[model samples]
Target: MITVVTNVDLFSTFQHVLQPLTLKPLQVVLAYSGGLDSHVLLHLLARYQHLYPQHAYLAVHVHHGLSDNADAWLGHCQQTAAALGINFIAEKVVLNVGRRESLEAQARTARYQAIAKHLNNGSLLLLGQHLDDQLETFLLQLKRGAGVKGLSAMAAQMPFSLQENCLIVRPLLTHPQQMLVDYASQAQLSWVEDESNNDQSYDRNFLRHQIIPSLKLRWPGIAHAVHRSAELCAEQQALADEIAEIDVVTCAHSFSGLNIAGLAKLSKIRRNNVMRFWLAAQYLPMPSRHHLDKVWLEVVNAADDANPQLRWQAGEFRRYQGVLYNQQQYAALKDVVITLEHTLSQRITLPDNIGTLHLQDLIQDTIHNKSGVDSSNAIGDNDSGCCVKAPLAHDKVTIRFRGEGTCHPVGRSGSRSIKKLYQEYQVAPWLRDRIPLIYYGEALVCAVGLWVCKGYEAQAGLYWHVTRER
Candidate 1:
């Protein structure tokens, strides 16, 4: 039932929703769009702040620049925030209109990204999505044949995507749009109306203008019914997530991948559920049903000797030696050779996020220490078993990603191919080229973090270490 909200009832509703949150004296940011719903929320927050002045309050407006009147709307938001005695910030974001996703989605992503920049950990962000907006989202997800997670619709409160411990809260989610309108009318609020809202080209606008009004007329309590359904879906999804978490703990491999053998023991339904949960944990986009099926049939169930992979837009799933790995798509590393100065102690930054190589000139340090050991003797000896040798003064020391000939490592007796060594070391195939190969002129010295070539073992001079980027 749509309750007619007076000023007192509206304030009571706001207090009832916020009281349970038990919010500390944190930064409270309101997403004020200068629209009716947000304007009503802004008024209620101003009143709430007046009563409880412990929390810091601010209003932020995201200007998408999609509408010609966007500048005017921003001005209205600024003026209204100032009148309410709240700090205000306006962020302008560029939208990728030509992208495959709808313009509405692009605008929303850009807006949230802009807002996320202003928030710190544990900040509270308030949105103005009411029950009517929730209904629209639920209907749209249904149209797309969504599962429980999608059908759960917009959550009343959720963790902010960009910041840990930050929350995105919609206090007005349980109230219908009529309540907001009634409150705004009673409060004599003024707000800007975006012209784009009337355009039926957008799916949301079409639903708001045509579909929902008729539905409300036919079934007076449809909004509450849809809201109940969404809440039920959210509850069911939470239960499924719990089961997936327990399954993940059992099937997790040592290398941060899933164990296919362990997964095979579970039923197909449970396996699929666990796979989705695993992908989400890796922060990869959820794959389509077809792609998920391909992961099971082609990657997980492939012949033991044959490598199998299933790729999607954001990432890929690959099976290697009974383990399933989820990897985000990375750009191919170029064959770039970098020269290093052996005379000085320095750090070299590698390309393609491989991290840095630190070279310490032990001989230089020993000379500075005025030690009894002769520097010449240290340079001449080649039996220290260190991963890197002190290079000759005229030797062109360089680093490369690829190696040519076979190498006899310091601990190993015989020579072997680089590929064979990597296999012996159990290195994944995709990471083979990313390993930095140290070289003195054309002779391979060491594959960092792996092994040093027997001929290039250091006697007592330079030492090298590799630190990978997180």
Candidate 2:
């Protein structure tokens, strides 16, 4: 059951919730919307700011260009914030909606992205989602038969952005819609009413205006009870996350991927749990259940040489030599060859701006057999040094991306084809041609980020060590 709350009582609640915030230094920014809920939140925050002057307070209004009154809303937010003596920032964002996609979802995504740009290392993005909104979210998730994570609905506090370290807090989660409206009326705050909110074509509006009101009439305490259930789901989700975390470390083949052998040992549900958690933690879009099933059946369980891949909107899952790879984007490769001069201190930029390279000093004593020589620890003794031939100005230092040659890298027992070496290094087939091969005259000398030919091994006394930095 919900209790009738006075504006004073609401202020007390807000003050109580904000106590934890003062322990650490944070830039507090309100996600302001010129609505009853947000207006009340803004008013209360403004009032509270005087008591806690140590914390920085700011407001950001996202202008999602869907409504004709968007400009007016922006104006209202700025004006109101000015009257309250608060700093205000307004951001305009374009919504790119697909023909069949939900315009609401796309607008929300665009709005959050625009807001995310303003948030940095230590930011607290205060949102104005109240109990009614939480109820609506829970109902919607239920209708769609969402799992624990989804059914947990919006938390009072949670990580806001996938790309940035920010926290979104809904301090008014327990504040009823009536309490906010009453506060707005008592304060005589001016707010613009968006006409789109009344359009029942939107699912939220339908639930808010048409469905939830009728349900509330019959069961007045439903919102509070549902919120309690959501809280319980949140606890359950946390426990599930703990199990997944332990399992992830066990299943990891390399740094980030699940070893198919380790993964196969888990039950199907556990595997799915880890996969979903892994994707979400890595900031990659989680595949739909259908797509996840396809990946499990086709890619993870496929033959060693199957080379199966699954792609969705934002990322792709690939299998490379018995390991799974989730790549956010394929690196753009360039075919253009670059000409560079060899100088000890000269750093050359590679073509297509792939990366930068330079001579990383020369070492004595270590004629690099299998790499891993510390140039910093180079010994100057002639007996320990492999004498290197300095590049003559007449010899053109040509850098080519792709070449057909049978060249031997220094200290390797036998000469292998470059194509074979690329495979041996497990370089992606599409990226092989993009690895720049360095040549002094017609002799293949080194492949940047790869190997130096045997003949071109750093000769003693100040032999050059090629270093590639991306």
Q: Pick the candidate with the highest lDDT.
A: 1
Please list the Cα RMSD from the true structure of every candidate, rounded to 1 decimal place.
8.8, 8.1
Residue 352's lDDT within candidate 1 is: 71
Model 2, which residues run further than 4 Å from truth?
Answer: 1-8, 97-99, 303-305, 327-470
lDDT of 1 by residue, 1-470 (tens): 12334754776877787766645788888988999999998988888888778988889999989889999999999999988888899999988888998888788878888888888778889999999999999999888888998899999999886666898899989889888888888778899998888999988889999999999999989989999999999999999999999999889763357888889999988998898888776555678788888988998888878878777786678887678887655556647888875446667888876667766666666768644334455443323213356778788988888777799987788999998988886557777777777788788888776778887776665666555553
Q: Each model's C-alpha lDDT?
A: 0.80, 0.73
Give the TM-score (vs. native) of candidate 1: 0.74
Q: Which ten residues in a row have the lowest lDDT in candidate 2?
A: 378-387
